[model samples]
Target: MAFLFPLSTFLLPAGGEYGDVRASFDEAKLNAYLAKSVPAVKAPVTIKQFKSNPTYFLTDARTVSIQTAHQVEREYTMLAAIHNYNSRPTTAPEARVPVPQVFVLCEDKEVIGTPFYIMEFLEGRIFTDMSMPGVPLEVRRECWLSAVRALGALSSLDPKDVGLEILIKSLSKVSLAQAAVKDIDTGEPVGEITGWRELIGWYESNLPDERKTGVRIVHGDYKLDNLIFHPTENRVIGILDWELCTLGSPLADLGNLTQPWVFDLADVGTLMVGFKNNPGAEPISLEDLEREYCRVTRQPYPIVEIGFARSWMLFRLSVIMQGIAARRARGQASSEQAHLYASFFNVLGRLARGVLEDEGYLPKSRAKL
Candidate 1:
């Protein structure tokens, strides 16, 4: 299905002439149009499209007509925000997660009939399957570990420094102001202390411990496929899909990223939501990823937090599938295989409940999920 405005989704057409085809459209035509209309969109060789990977953004485009103006502004604004993050001198060295550079954002919607942007054409590898089939086990271990390190590096960045404070309240629901830098040793603001200048959403209530965690620019959707890896090395060359990016709990990204290991299809059967555990990389565990994340962030291993985050993410993924399924039922399915995801709603709910039970938050059940 061709998305108007592009990013892989750089284009899911809005109303007017593009009013209809939101549910289904020709990707080849869209790709060709992108190649012709946007010269900067090179081969996009790094971004490979796979139907099974579940990128279905099934929101109905009918009501989009009313929201078109607001949507246009929001879309272009986010593109600029991310570009700001990438263009910062300190971002590449500190975050270690590369973002495609936005050369220009055309919000007029007159040229392309929808908002679109020209981004750097990253040439690398995007493994749709989390298992990373055909790759060596050592490579898989290193690649996965590198992804963790990248996330940690991103989390450690101060949002204000990256020009991301403006997005916190509107997106992540946090208000940002310049507080004096805190000293790790003395536990007091060291810089010029100022009011309304602190990362206040540091404590997460969802976790068992009220530990103060670093506020990070959360990549709401962080997973293997969303990343572009170096063609030969195990390093991560780029991060994709910033639509869900925001300033929020680092745990949200960690939770979303680590769900694959927790929901091994062999162990949970129907409850397994997305990717399956790769038997080839059996030596590596979810804990290993957590260890790398903690090591990079210099934070203690958060066992309880991990459990909560994983279960929460499972429920969240299921809800997304459920929404797509609803759109499918309405005959507005953005892609062909949306029916495959409809059935996962109940099973994923069971998995989320099961995890809660295991953590002693819910009562145990004799019935198998």
Candidate 2:
């Protein structure tokens, strides 16, 4: 017997509709998209029950909440669209996915308040951390390889052919810089910090000085949790999350994926160890993972070349955390680990300064600061 439920209340957002910053999954539209696009899904079934399942697969924001059903469906459709845009042949990897006759939904705005698309749903298990106990070593390695290769394939795509010019054009330099800073969660402007280097220096130094393309499709948040794997098949069923999809340096995407692996080593084993099916079954070393990713992607080993990606990733994280810290400081949100957040701001400031100083982006007069 199959059972489904309304995961959560779909509340009309209270704040300004930021640029996909606080965007969320729209369940009604997701269902409609699937019903219209997929040939097999003829009727929309009523959500029988609604409950939340803790997703060991993602961070707090992406977890299944009141609207999990919608999120699942939305993610499925988005992944499908990306796959189609990539010119991924039906004969391509993980081709068993159902191909819907229709791809677009007409009542997208009415149901989800957005123009939404659809893709066939995939049934698979996800390992947020490659190092899990129940998973075999070989399977874990394959998962890592598949993820890196998928990212490489995505990076190698042609934006014009895939109809991604508009998405890429929508991004602004300020927004990108702000995003880099804001990810640290601090309220301070990146340039104002003392003694610390700016994050931009590191990015500029690490990435190719020349922009390869005006805009390349970027999966803003590329990480293990966002990847879906066909547990038994030893393959990635789909790449998930489109909320942050845009046109930017594909290197940014690569940087994001490998960031956690590089810095934050202290939390790597503890925070990620339990995410996979079995905790501590297969411990993946960062060195091995980095080497494999380089080989599969055919990019120079990032660990050897740029190293800015990791710095960029950390800088972004620090910025995000600082923003959170700032919010907490203002009494906007409660924080048990107030000290941790506070420390994040200081760390971000220092890191940013370090990066800028290293790249000569910081003015000579303020070298000490």
Candidate 3:
């Protein structure tokens, strides 16, 4: 059976303080939008904004959330997320999902500057850190394995089957290299971080032919925090934040999953602070996780050109972080962790440089922080 459940009857208190600093939406305007756009809801439906940053909302009987696309187009990512969720195969008995059923797409400038969509609110816990305190190690392991299965399931599907051919383009290693060059040429600011330019140059020069492969729908941000776990079990009930979903190498998702481990944040003053130090359970290594994922999917291990893939993914992330930093600087960012995100540009850049050096694409040299 589908993991369907009633919207939580009791309104849970907001997880954090609500204020101007936190991203929020106008309830009156949202209600007005709903009144006109979604026929299911009556005119006088109430909208309550959650205290969480990049505010989520709980309506009378449904949940509404907003996604603002500053660098990448929001509509495309939002639609992709919905499509992936709805189109995902239900073959796995254990893979229960409360996929978002987007009711309305609102682009009315008066409602909000950027476009937003209303979808079903899923009730579950979101573990933002690896250290799932108070949770059993076996349960944590199960959760991690469930996530891997979800990723494998997502990667195994054809993008064409879900009508994502146009919205999400398949990217090859060569295409990624070319895109890197294009970004640099367009003055995307390759800051004076030590190996930033060298890494790009490596990509431009060593474009590998064998790295080209079939495209899969990639959840750009596939981590424990983005997944919604069952209230009492280790199973993943729902996936959130499709803002970064795209068509790319499946390895990109793997790279994203393993990026945090590649760059330990013990002393980094970023958002992922305490979790690293106090991880309640011993985390699984990326290698073991990848092996199990390959075994479950019956796909060969991606052992070749793994380094290049890591560098490409990290470099792309650094570019994205740069855009976030720009938005935060201009007072246009919506994420409550905007400042923390802004601080990650250098850290990510250095990490990318480190990957390139390890891959023999660049000499062993530290990037100037």
Candidate 4:
């Protein structure tokens, strides 16, 4: 449906790395003022998820894992991502999503120090694992279905109608400056010695025709863990993390949503969970997920093209992790385990190649490194 990213809930993050960067803001003025501007704000604001009222920094060290920056463009896109989705008419009762209230976007860095916005803090569940530990298996299944159907609802809307047409020009671009990637199995170059541009070409050449699905809102990082589900219900209430929002093929979102199915969750670790061998439950498949999406959108699944999207999504994920590795090397990693990503990217690459072969995008013989 749409390239939705992970499900996440925001809590107030303690002012640390971002504190010094935004020292210019007089909290006495900006703080205590939110209560007056946003009725949703109460005197005592607390942090549950800690993205709660994140203070972003302009420095590279503060580059949030999800494209955090002080640029107005980033804020505009983030606002567009949230506003467009919230503004869309609820075609289905299930499509009604409770999102964090974004009250303002002050571009002038002079206002709250490092260009900040005041938004409501939401309370919900952020399932880091697909297994949805401790939750009933059926509820887990329904939550996944609800996300699918929601994405289907997103796909049904026109970017133009939602006022997101401007995002098409600002689509995220991947740099091909990195060294050539070697095949995980054969230990041979996967593309030309020259650059990744050629490698991208090799896979895309065999992908199904790209025109079928057409353009739609691509969430860029759409996934279950990225969402914020209801506290005790199977439905999605608030959708957060709009840093990666853009306009692209609906398959981009679809491919991302189902990417885990193509790989072994064992390879990635418990941080990620897939339907098959999902920890404590019987193995499941995307048949029902696809069916639900199709039913909501009133369209058949693009089985062939989805392979291309899946491969691309995996590749994109590997690259993101690679970036984390780079950050770790520079001693700017946000997490203590950031260094571990170096080995993970290769597994993702191998998985991508597997999708290409299974989807018939490439001959099995040729796809093997």
Predicted structure with the largest lDDT when compared to the true one: 3
TM-scores of the candidates in the order shown:
0.67, 0.60, 0.72, 0.74
Residue-by-residue lDDT tens digits, candidate 1, 1-369? 112122332111111113223333344544455556655454322222222331222122111111122233443455466567666676567554566555445464444355544445455666656666567778888988888888887777666665665353331121111122233445453221111111112123344342356566777788877777766678887776666666666877888887766675764454333344445444257778888888888888755576666666666665566655555555577775676775555566566666666677657767565
Q: Which model scores highest in TM-score?
A: 4
Assess each prediction's global lDDT (C-alpha) against the native. Answer: 0.55, 0.47, 0.58, 0.55
> Per-residue lDDT of 10-109 in model 2, one digit per residue for the tens?
1111111112213444546655664566444444433222112211111121112112223344444444555565455643543222222223333445
**Model 2 regions more than 4 Å off:** 1-40, 48-81, 86-109, 112-119, 166-197, 201-207, 210-215, 264-291, 297-305, 330-345, 348-369
In candidate 1, which residue ranges exceed 4 Å CA deviation? Answer: 1-94, 165-211, 266-283
Write the number of the candidate with greater lDDT, choosing between 1 and 2: 1
Give per-residue CA lDDT, model 3, range 1-369, as digits (tens). 011223342122113223232444566786777777787655555443444434444456544444444322443444545455555575454332334555666666677555665555566656656656666677777888888877766666666655664355332342333323323224553233335667677766865443344677677777767776676667676766665676657777766766655655553554542233334424665677788778755767865656776777777776666666665555677887877876676676677777777667678874343
Candidate 4 has an lDDT of 0.55
Candidate 4 lDDT, 221-297, residue by residue in tens = 77776676666677776555556777667777778888667656676675455555554553235777777777876
The ten-residue window of minimal lDDT in model 3 covers 1-10
Q: RMSD, each candidate, Å?
A: 14.1, 9.6, 6.6, 7.5
Off by over 4 Å in 4: 1-25, 32-98, 166-175, 178-198, 203-211, 274-284, 365-369
Better of 1 and 4 by lDDT: 4
By TM-score, the candidates rank as 4, 3, 1, 2
CA RMSD (A), model 4: 7.5
Model 1 residue 317 CA deviation (Å) reads: 0.5
